[model samples]
Target: NNRPHPEYSLKYNKSRENRLIAESSYNHVITFFEGLMNHREIAIPIKHIDFSIGRICVLEVNRDITQSDIHILKTLAKMMYPLMISDKKFLNLETSRFDYVLSDLMNNPKPNMLLMRKKLSNFKFDLDSNMYLLCLCDLDNINSKSKVNYVKQMVQGIFEKHYVFVFDKNIIVLYNNKNSFDYFKKCKEYEEFLEFIKNYTLSVGVSKLFDGISGIRNAYFESLSAINFANRLNCIYSKEPSINFYDDYVLHDLVYDFVAKKKLHYILDSTIINLLADNNTNLISTVKCYLDCGENLNFISDKLGIHYNTLKYRINKLKTKYFIDLKNPDSLVKLKLAIIALEISKGYDLDLGLN
Candidate 1:
């Protein structure tokens, strides 16, 4: 090939040099940005806020906040703070105000801005840094259309530094602040919350409080986990920690739907009652053994101090009475599901025998 012209070669070299320079500069800028991000101070905005019982303080005030605005903020804070501290109280604020505040906050689309300032200022309590969420509310069991609104109001009435959100037909109350999460954990409030749910025929769940907004997604899932746990455990309340919601949602939906439609009891009642009766009403041992042996009659019988033939006889009797064949994999699945359904429906009671 003929030698390239010097000018052409020089021009090409210059272009290549500029491209290398630009790439080097771009890499330098990226490194600098990464350093800045790594070293940037992460502010815990509410650190100074005292969240102790009966110690109320205004957390923030919006800039250019008007006198009417101040009155509204103070009124809301004062009204809501006491309610947060005292869950027994009902809040009856002007419906317009409530709607306006919630709408504004949700739409603000800013971090720690005027809407947050307004909302936080009205709440008189401090948030515990290590908050856990316990969502206590009924599912679609609300008798009246207004009851749904009432549950929202009840949740708002209990709002503190923690964020409260409604997931599905349930109200999720975030319990945060150092000792706040501990309060529920200590008072066995989780259990009590479950009892309240049972009284209302509601399903409830608890989420482990992940810190901050990033953790909010985790908290939401945790709340979902609690709901799933409740469904799987078949109780009004559950604190199950290992439920994989993504894997279990479909299964839970089926069980919840069955229970809601009143079909679960019919499928499970006869089998559960028969199992209980055959086991001499020793509910715990029977369930434990049945579950332990994968519902295998021979294994369950060997473990339960019963003869294998006797176990086989009992299983057959249950199969006949409930129209469920324990030998069939599909039938076994249905029977297990029915047992879980009855367990949850009866608040995890081992003595009820599916009645």
Candidate 2:
């Protein structure tokens, strides 16, 4: 395909030529393209580089390509192949170092901050600058090492100054913010990452910006918590990839912990418990939908696919029968917390510990 012109094409059987060269016990082949373009082509097979026939060093000249020229090219290719292998080995070694440091930092309950800072300094990371963590929760789904490396490379490309590594079946990215913190720029980079990973069903959880290397452990947990919230709430578990920030779920953090301890129901109003106990799930669903719709009856009716009057009737029944009022702000807050508890409880067992 690398021809001088579209019409000046050669019907060269490259594979047949390679077979002929292999059969002849020769390391190179010299082909004359005089009929096509008065050119001489030399193809030297790089035996020790990759695969069975490694690679080829092709030289096309308008004049003769001699055996001496082939020998020089082969010598250069052979010399360069070791450097290539060395570079790959160096890359793997560097990756393993990063992986080891990250595993120690994340898993150790009391990591030596001074030692960690000194070790990170070797990688040219400034301890005083802002640090951010991004957790790619679906890296486990990517079974190939090459794909994992591609994802790491993509993340590094998006955030120029970043440390990308995999841990516990997830990809953890530590983005170093050397310049002044800019929310818009961070968001743009996140958008670019999402665009690159759109093909995979990945859930990206971003931690809030932290200052100094001391905050790295906290940042790691924050990113993990954001991803956990996304999964617990079923907010962004879908066919498409989603990017969630820790700030977006900061308030939910406390509520999630409170409910996870199975302690939230102790203060739950009797009304919510009775409503949840009702055999008709629509009653509880109607209540949850009402709070979610911002107490707007019309919106609730449309979402629940019920008539406006019928929705009002249900609300009236809630007030009279269950002693619950949707209009009161205090009541609305209670209902919101109750719904959060209900949803989180569903992930455990059907029981909300109301008994």
Candidate 3:
């Protein structure tokens, strides 16, 4: 380290050992140097010039510099600033061009899907051969643009084989399904990646493995849905940083309440839902328990601490009061759908233990 003052020695220590050397008397009689430009300092023989962006040419002298030397250095630094800033902007633009190219190809589909495949092929993405998983990390709290870039690059490096991109302002990472001994092993890897950047309050949605470009669009959509709905479901239960797996949500298209629309709501007749919609409805809970207990009256009765006949009576009330039959399989399926829609609409009865 070249320091104008020797006392400014760069120091680091591990354990209980350290040294501070303050006696390096090597001053510039004839010293060739390269410097601290990135930190915005310019090292010179006599006076250190904090120059601006333009290129500077300094005429060297053997002796200590006078006031004239200081003036010339300041003048050169002032001239350099504009050119350096311009060069930086140009470099950023060039880096961003590649990002834009990948973005357009992934987001906007063209007439020829094969051409898009060709484009990705040229970029060294062998989607056809590898079992790929797509992950979209939602940046809920990180607001700095440079930090966002850094996080994206960090994840990309961690999964070096993956295609990492910032599409729609989310970090999208695509990587291969690794060689794992079991499901637990696979989950550990996923946990490692998420935990590494835990400093940033973000949630990630992961897609199940799929080969090739055919399902790429759907995988991206799946990841987006995961980050959005998973975190929401977690928040509903007072959990932080929800990570949703596409596979965990069976019939994922129907699981998200926001996507259900007015159609599913109408499926659950207004009368039946009203009967079950109270914030502390035992009837609704009994229904989910009944299903979970494999329709065994004894099992649910014991679990709910309800007398078997009493549970039977409440269940039969559907058929007698609303002409809805729980015993009938078709009717049961319809009721389940209706109840799901009802539960979503109200977001009520967390104590019901439906999940």
Q: Quantify all predictions' global Cα lDDT against the true fold.
A: 0.45, 0.65, 0.53
Distance from true position, residue 6, model 3, in Å?
A: 23
Q: Name the lDDT value of residue 186 in candidate 2.
A: 62
Best by lDDT: 2
Q: By the TM-score metric, which is better: model 1 or model 3? A: 3
TM, every model? 0.34, 0.63, 0.59
TM-score pick, better of 2 and 3: 2
Model 3 misplaced regions, further than 4 Å: 1-101, 130-133, 178-188, 197-199, 248-252, 255-261, 265-280, 296-310, 323-327, 347-355
Ten-residue region with minimum lDDT total, candidate 3: 14-23
Candidate 2 wrong stretches, greater than 4 Å: 1-99, 176-190, 235-239, 248-262, 348-350
Model 2, position 86, has a per-residue lDDT of: 64
Across 201-221, the per-residue lDDT of candidate 2 in tens digits comes to 467888899888677778888
lDDT of each residue in 1-355, candidate 1, tens digit only: 1333435322322232322322222111011123212221111111112321121122222343345644564455556565554542232222444344433443444545544545645754232256555555544332222334444554565454445554443565656665445454455444644444443445555565455433444555556665655455643444433213233344554565566665555555455545643544444345446765785676687788988777666666555655556557765565566555555556533343334
Model 3, range 220-282, lDDT digits (tens) per residue? Answer: 777776666565455456666645677755443473343244443444555455455443367
- Supply the global lDDT for candidate 3: 0.53
The candidate with the higher lDDT, 1 or 3, is: 3
- Candidate 3 residue 98 C-alpha distance from true site, Å: 6.4
